[model samples]
Target: MLLVVNIGNSNIRFGVFEGDECVNSWVMNTKPYKTEDELYSQFKIAFKNYDIDINRIKDIAVGSVVPHLTYPVRKSLQRLHNIKTTLVSKNTPTELTFMSPQMGTDLYANAYYAFKKYEGTKIVVDFGTALTLTCVDKNGEIKGVVIAPGVITSLKSLIGSTAQLSDIEMRTPKQTLGKDTEECMQSGVIFGFLSMVEGLIDRINKELKEETYVIATGGTGHIFAPLTSKIKIYDRLHTIKGLRELYITQKKEGLQ
Candidate 1:
């Protein structure tokens, strides 16, 4: 069994993969100040709840965007299972070439898997703490990326800044023209982002002069993916799957 962990700004995702199949997955809130012991306890509880044996985990792969939590997570895994984790980074051996050496490991993992699974021009739209679109071409070269405020990130900022506005459930509004305050916020945030995604894909397609495969992933992907035909695929486990694939590739190359 391979344990894959993706630590993002908002959440930390864990996947237990048996060969190419992911048997189980879990998500937890990201608390940067948590100690190694606390993290170990959390992992233990999650594994227990899922009936997964800690001893069965053969290897661990981690892709972390939050620098502060990386060491503690690695330490927790090491202490609990006596296993060293392979951290995914730009330096990790993969088929995709990154345009920026300093790009986030999570993004690199996303692109690595996308490049392997899909053909021709591909864009991975990840709606995490920060909304990101990573473009990779048929030749396995990363073209570029587009970054914007995430759906929930934007909503939180708006509520925090405004005097009267409060949080509302994120869903597609019944109409583009909102009838009430909650609907208004939902309309603006959800529909607004929907347009942004579509417009950007259109612009990117214009630049590429070819059809592009867009894969959506992350927490808010489910909310927006169903509302648009532009988004072809929505797999919440994309990042973790990528990390698992990266681990397999590294192990094959004797790098792990």
Candidate 2:
């Protein structure tokens, strides 16, 4: 089994792939102070819950967006699997063109997977800590990336910053015209993002002079996926799957 870890700003996602099939996955809230033992315990608990032995995991692949938690995660994986843990980056073999060093590793995973898995000009919308819009042409050349405030990040910022406004459920209100404060916040956050997504896609299409395949992937992807007209695919597992594919390719090339 291949263990894939996508360490994001908000959460750490773990996926266990048996051959081509991802049989198990877990999401852990990110905490910088989390010890290696704590990390191992989390993995062990997930393994036990799924009846997957720790020893069965042959290798590890890490797609990290957080730098502070990188060594800790790799160390934990090393202690558990006692095997190689590959760090995925732009350097990893992939179809998408990488030009910026500031590009997130998660974006690389999404871009490569979209170009190889879906095949063609693609726009990947990631609704995570930061909403990331990445465009890749049919020839596997990356067009650009647009970054904006993520759904939950925006929510946290609003709730944390405001004096009167409190946290509300992160769900779309039944109507765009909210009735109460809760409904109003939900409407603003949810519907506002929906509009932003579609509007941006339209602008991107105009710039590209062509339509592109759109895929949304993230913890909150399902929320915006149905509401947005541009998104055709919603798969939360996209990042981990890309990590798995990257590992396989890198291993073949003896980069691991």
Candidate 1, residues 71-185: lDDT per residue as tens digits?
A: 9999998888899998877678877876687788888888988988888889999999899999999888999999999989999999999999999988788899988899999
Residue 232, model 2: lDDT of 96
User: 22-131, model 2: which lDDT tens digit per residue?
Assistant: 88888888965588889888877777888888888888899887788899889988987888688877788765576787888888888888878886689999999999
Highest TM-score among the candidates is held by which one?
A: 1
Steric clash pairs (candidate 2): none
The Cα RMSD of model 2 versus the native structure comes to 1.3
- Residue 185, candidate 1: C-alpha displacement in angstroms: 0.3
User: Clash number for model 1?
Assistant: 0
Q: Tell me the deviation in Å of residue 231 in model 2.
A: 0.8
Q: How well does each candidate superpose onto the true structure, as a TM-score?
A: 0.97, 0.96
* Global CA lDDT computed for model 2: 0.86
